[model samples]
Target: MILLKCFMVIFVGQFLDVTSVYNPMLTYNIRFNKLRFLPNVTGNYTIFQQKDKQYVSGYIQRPTTDEVNKYQLPVFHRCNPEGLNCEYFQSWTLTDLCTLLKDKNQIWSKWYGAFDPPILCPINQYTYVFRNSTGEVNIFLKWYPDVLNYQWKITQKLYSGDFYIGSYYNPMLTYVVRIVKITSYPNITWNYSVDTYKGKYYVNGNTSITTDKLIDKVVGVFERCAPEGINCEYFQSWTLTDICPKLLDKNQIWSSWYGRSFDPPVVCPINKIHYQIRNGTFDLDPIIKIYTDATNYYWKLTQKMYAGNTLVGSYKIETVFLGLSRIDDEGGVVSTDPSGLAYSPERSRL
Candidate 1:
């Protein structure tokens, strides 16, 4: 039977930041139990080949005092010359180390060293102080075989610039970063704002204005990072002009137009008269009125003439010639013939 076992250790601290040091030595040692192989009575044995490539992968979570106390171990793995023990070592700058630490959660508690607290050193000086603290600083060191292929899953979206603001200076616009589905890591949504006024450009606020004066011409770069600040993927570089239009509010109103003659005239035989303004235009306004008499039904169409805002005259249609004839209340027979004289229909009534 093959057996596997894993052990974890934790250290706590308060703060962790980058230092100016170029390259600092770091090391970690891991030990494994002796291996055993079954012996065969009679057979040809083949030797297995192994590669020397190595890699380290692990994640740190925010550590609490109770968890640290429960997980702490007394004996530390020591380097051995016999090759039974594995020792991993590397040299890293303060900035590089800080970047790695930022990817971990509760970073200060899981990896800080009790004997060697990280210190800032002068650029010209090679020597730096490494002192022990109760739980003030932190660093992480570990190693494993390359086959482990360690990866860190992003839990939260990280943002750096002003993605949204109430006001903006002339020629500088605010923008935002949006990340869609990520194939490398599933179920992670990254969205944040990048504000120009916050001076996020080049990690400094100062930027010279270019000749382009159009508010839409301004552009800003946005990034999405896994683990907050390390190993980020460039999501989008958007301009304020492009995004502002989408944020504007829109209002629209729609009106219905009614009134066209039916194939068969509608019969209105009731005592109540009904009137409807069907079509109203600059040139023509048509009003339809329907009523009933004791003996016969009657339908009337009227048009009020207007020259600009001044009312010139009003005309009523004769039922015998609905479209061709019109009778004016003040000026009878308003419809004219080709000779420009008023023409009246033979049966012009009601």
Candidate 2:
């Protein structure tokens, strides 16, 4: 085998100064949402206070005998107050999850340790549970304290080896941690849905579909605009045919709505005689769900069925990314905090 040496590069971008009144993102807290793609790994951790000092104590278990030497790469994202205009705040490649504990170079390193099945370089297959761990948030802010004032979403992923195109390594772990300045979780606040017969996207005010290809044309994109809601910038869009298979992932994450109590067409068959969406634009499930922490941003999605070149019927939906809500206590649709809802990694508790 030919030996090859590769260099890792760090690219730092411009950061909006937190001192500016527009981005005073001070005072933040962290939350983790645990989601397992594979069954071999499972764990949970939380931040606790002891003797005026805060620390994290928890465990990450490996039920199988598989071990990995690769480290986790974390990418931090900072968004605007409206949860729009997100940019990378900072990032780090953690060679050891216990670096906050064993790295003597860190100031508080002496105060932390891995108690059960210690975590050192080249992580072992044994389950890991640590006490007197580094203060989750403190160690984070020590590098960029000014960042605490804004909203942040950090995603970390680990693999068995170098992350490349077709090298082929199973995903070992993924961590998604959200840091916010406020307590309430961000969710959509939808106003209304277009009517079946009188909606704007309806062709010549017709409500029935003359074509069997109900999904002939589809457009989905995220849109942002000026405070006045004018002069908007439409991001790139995606074209999809049958949105049926995409529903599986959405059902897992947004279980509250796409749960067992809910069901849609299994196969969006187009080779039919006549198709009619009796409700027009209502009750149509979205392709993407719960990825955004932005309650203020909206997605414009349109789907249309056609007969030759004539437009028969169509549906246009305008909703915030997090707006595809769940049922509330009184049977009304409502969007709430993402704490217990999102399919994310609950990695931090500050």
Candidate 3:
């Protein structure tokens, strides 16, 4: 039996800027609320899969006296897009996470190349940051794999059982990692931030990208979801067959336009990395007739770079057709239900 875990409860297009589909990225957000505990907690997380990948990052202040063995475990909860109807998902001990860090990646000195903590779970007076610089992120951490084409959510319970933060308290730590979907006004360009290096993640700003390995393949996705990227219902996922190829896919939902309705993805995976691109921008202008039908919905377009099964980097553009409507693959058109936040398609109209 294939059991799934919990998810996020995003209020479609609430306060996020992202896009996706072929590059299945379940929009998410991180909420580190202040609570009565020995130490302060904060986190930065990413729940997206380029060639299918998930990542977690954040920091916990130096505790007065904390040990990994003193806590229960980090429990993850799942929920709906609107941040409702939650349930228990899974758990991971701080020690186990540490072991993976020490034994596997040997990243004790550099957790994601920016933050570092003692491999032995150093419990002295010191602040440290930890996150998956390289590895598999729990898919159900936000949404189930099967639901990639639909709107979804889940809950996460951050409790320090005297281990992570070294103070078992009543109100557990709540680490909310919300990956927001981009839905800017139609045709507005959005820049792609963040860069990933040798398992280390970086929100690349003016810095240059560290890797330019021969890109194997790239998945370009154009997905339609609610304003806040909820209940993503339509998916137009395609792939670049060579080092650099045009944006074309069998899921030509953009076929309506005589082929000139939207901007094409920039050819990528060149011999050299272009730092100049850090300031460049992209947007969604898919002129297909299907898009004309759903002018009321927000669309997210993403292009993910990969080397083998590894994700080298990615490009994202989030925006919505100012007046785009949504279409339901199952019902032809979205039902006029105010309570309905997304138009979930039974299947991708691929």
Model 1, position 266, has a per-residue lDDT of: 17
Better of 1 and 2 by lDDT: 2
Model 1 lDDT tens row, 21-87: 1122422222122111111111111112223211122221221111111111112222222211222
TM-score to native of every candidate shown: 0.14, 0.47, 0.27
TM-score of model number 2: 0.47
Clashes of 3: 48
Total residue pair clashes for candidate 2: 9
lDDT per residue for candidate 2 within 211-298, as digits (tens), equals 4444444344445543223566775555455445654443333222223322232234443432222222212222212232233333
Write candidate 3's Cα lDDT for 1-350 as tens digits. Answer: 11112122211211122222223344332222222222233333343323333333545454344443333333344334333333345544443544454553331223234446543544343566655433222433333343322322221222345322432121221211112232222222233343322211122122123465766776878778765557886578877656443433322333221123323323344334433223122222223212312333556767676777767667455443321133344424333233232232111110
Sort the candidates on TM-score, descending order.
2, 3, 1
**Deviation in Å, model 1, residue 122 alpha carbon:** 26
Tell me, what's the RMSD of every candidate?
A: 36.9, 14.1, 21.3
Model 1's TM-score against the true structure: 0.14
Q: lDDT at 167 for candidate 1?
A: 12
